[model samples]
Target: MKYKKTILATTILSALLILIALGVSLVVSPMVERKAEQLLTRYAARVGAIERCSFSRVEFSPLSRSLTLHDVLVIYRSPKGLRKSMDRLEISVPLRAAACAVPSLRPYVLPENGSMDVCNSITADGVSFSMPGLLAGSLKHAAISGVSADARHVRAILDGRRPEPVDLLEHAVIDGLDAVNLRATVQTGTGSAACTLGAFRLRGLHDLGIEEIRFEQLNAATNKERAGIALFGMDGFRAPDAATLRLLLSVRLDGKKSPQALDKDIEHVLPMLQQWLTATIPPVRVLAVEKASFRGSRPQDVMSLDLMRLDWLSNRPREMKTAVKDLVLPAQLVESNGLHLPGLKELRFNGESDTRDEDGRIRETGYLSLARFGQLRYNASYAVPGGVFNFSLMQLLSMTIHDAAFSFVDQGALAYIALNQHDPDMAGPYFNQALDYSFPGRDNDALRAALKVFTDRPGTLDIVKTTSEPTPLLRCFDVATLGRLWRVSATPGKESLYDQMRRLAPAR
Candidate 1:
């Protein structure tokens, strides 16, 4: 009877001890969780200026010093209003250095801990950011790891959104370009903000990378609106450097898609975004923006424009033009659409085109430059009053000559030859063999009435000081040719010079 009583007492004592231990553990866990969340919120608010950070479930193990949170929602104040959400966040602190968990990385103080496990987030389901009514960006199944506790540096594998292009033109069409496996690192200091993006490929485009992008700062606030930097802009541009900016970067995104639908509100607001930003944001300047393997209306009609990449600089509205006024090019631009431009050098644009209106007032003056092709260098301009390519220059033989010749000639040689009953003109039999042309009324000169357009000696122009008036296209010829049928029409005393030539020609 004594042995039975002792055994029973011992059993009851053991059970009571176990229950007490469990009660204590359960009671302390909530306190630890609260402390961990408070620390997280305090540090995060310092780094990102987080307004509110809420998590549905917070778990902490005091013994192990490990913390985890689920369904995290973070709000930040900057360029307009910004919001970020993540699925799970986990942080581990070594027991030896719990005090140094936040900032002042004493990685050396704790040799075992070279870097503090400040943040290890897993958006296993998805991640998202938004600006109230304006726009939203999303990425799925990404683990953005290794964020410094100080929040000055971080890396992410972002397979997600690039800024949606603002196409104000109605009935606008677009191509698909979704990125994948984008490995990017962002680091910011007092002077500038820099990013390195690589190992990324745009669907149907080349593998792209950004070697360097150093921005002056991301201006999140300018006092005009209670918004963030997205509202203000970046230092992507500087007015003093409108002519040129010394920067280097490489990125490509060419997607092929048919315009499936259009949201009228989105279309309207998209362009306003650029305009509204121009009024506030700092200029985000870049050295270049190039595209390759871009398809257009027809799949086979791959856009192989010589200066498409640089056109973005010159084509933007005047206020936004200075942002990237001079877009430099790489040595070679390539794409998957069987289109390639090798040995391309630079685009020295003046941000204007010569396309004139019906009144003949000089309109936009665009595309004037000294660019290289193969071993040859050339200058091309679409500066004509009507935006037609009025001039082209390159090497012809040894001398640097320009065949400023493009013809929609009038009363073509055949019609004139037939009208004259095969009468020999200034060109004689060669005139019959010359180009058959038409469009006779553009020229009003009576002396050279047979040929509406004539050639000239290609001379260079000062792009800055060049005249801005609607002018006729010059059809220049190799001046050194003894039997050259082309004449310099604009020369002083050109009529007299032509008269002598007419007298020497075989009688009509």
Candidate 2:
């Protein structure tokens, strides 16, 4: 009897222990799942922010330790105040491995079923983003099945597939992995663009290691339009490693036109453009055309041009212009290195008088080629009251003169007079008058004496007598002009001639 009782007690204790262990496993599993869900949610938020997107809803499953997110939306705003939205995004993630590995801490899991709406805001037909293996650290591989968006000013269809894997933590020395396959069509009003990927894979969390990631047959539409700019075809884009990113893009205008015709158009409009540009960026001194070409229709005035290759180093605007005027240089000029002009070579101008408005302003367009010495070859066209004028200068003197005038205007009479003498056209009358008042009663004899000492010319007296104008004894002289003349006469031996002229002139 005692033996039988002991056996029963042992059996009961074993059953109780087994039941307790089972309960613990059940409780721990659910807790782990909840932790994973929380971590994933946080990660999703971070990713969305970086991508400029948001998710409408997130669903979590405790039993499988998985998360399903849906209705991801991305938005963009155009310069014209138009808002665009991409919607209907869905993603799923498995947290089983992450949950089991870190029971006490939460694990991060990326979503699957990478799909989204494309260009929902601009076009009548909705676009899509389909990827088979889009999520990093997911259980299955994904690929983008289809993608569509507003192309040109209209909508078109796109079809292609690309698979890529990315490692997020390789550089950080963390154990992580990522892979993505994106295939889609970019739709436009007239045509389509396609992209295909071989593989994009990454491993090692902190120090990212990539394995054979490539983009193939990545092409855009043959034609498209947005705002006033035209887009040709996209050649291909590639990022071999973390250090470099490269892309090849080509584009043309909406219509067809000859390159020579385009060149002529740009030549006509460059001067006014230069003036306008100077008003904005003052450091630019010289704007020369490099090369120009054009394509498109004439009636609608639709065309495409390239000025990016022009030399722009000496083309900075003057400070005076900046303070007094609101000016706009071409986008190409602004983007170039204003301090270093190497590609510009020439500038050309052409235009039609008939096209000029009553105010003498004509519309024009053309191309520019920046060849060498930071020079630009431009083809321009426009209308002006006096007709179109296109000319190039080895140096831009007007800009220099303008700069000097503004810089010296704040100084006293002597400085102002000196500046005016260099360029009388730009000086104010007040400056001229001030100089006259300061030199009152100064006879030509004293002027001759001063000039004799500073100049080297032997026949200074003869030149002075010939150049001076008859005036009343108290009449004011143009100090600015006198100063400039003195400089010219004072060259080496000409100093004496300058002195003689000063003496022959009437006193102020």
Off by over 4 Å in 2: 1-140, 143-170, 173-181, 187-191, 202-211, 214-508
TM-score of 1: 0.29
Our tally of clashes for model 2 stands at 102
TM-score for each candidate, following the candidate numbering: 0.29, 0.22
- The alpha-carbon deviation from the true structure for residue 423 of candidate 2, after best TM-score superposition, in angstroms, is 61
Pick the TM-score winner: 1
Error of 2 at 136 (Å): 20
lDDT, candidate 1, 268-380, per-residue tens: 44444434323332233324332222333333333222122221122222222222233343323332433332222322322323332223222332333322211111232
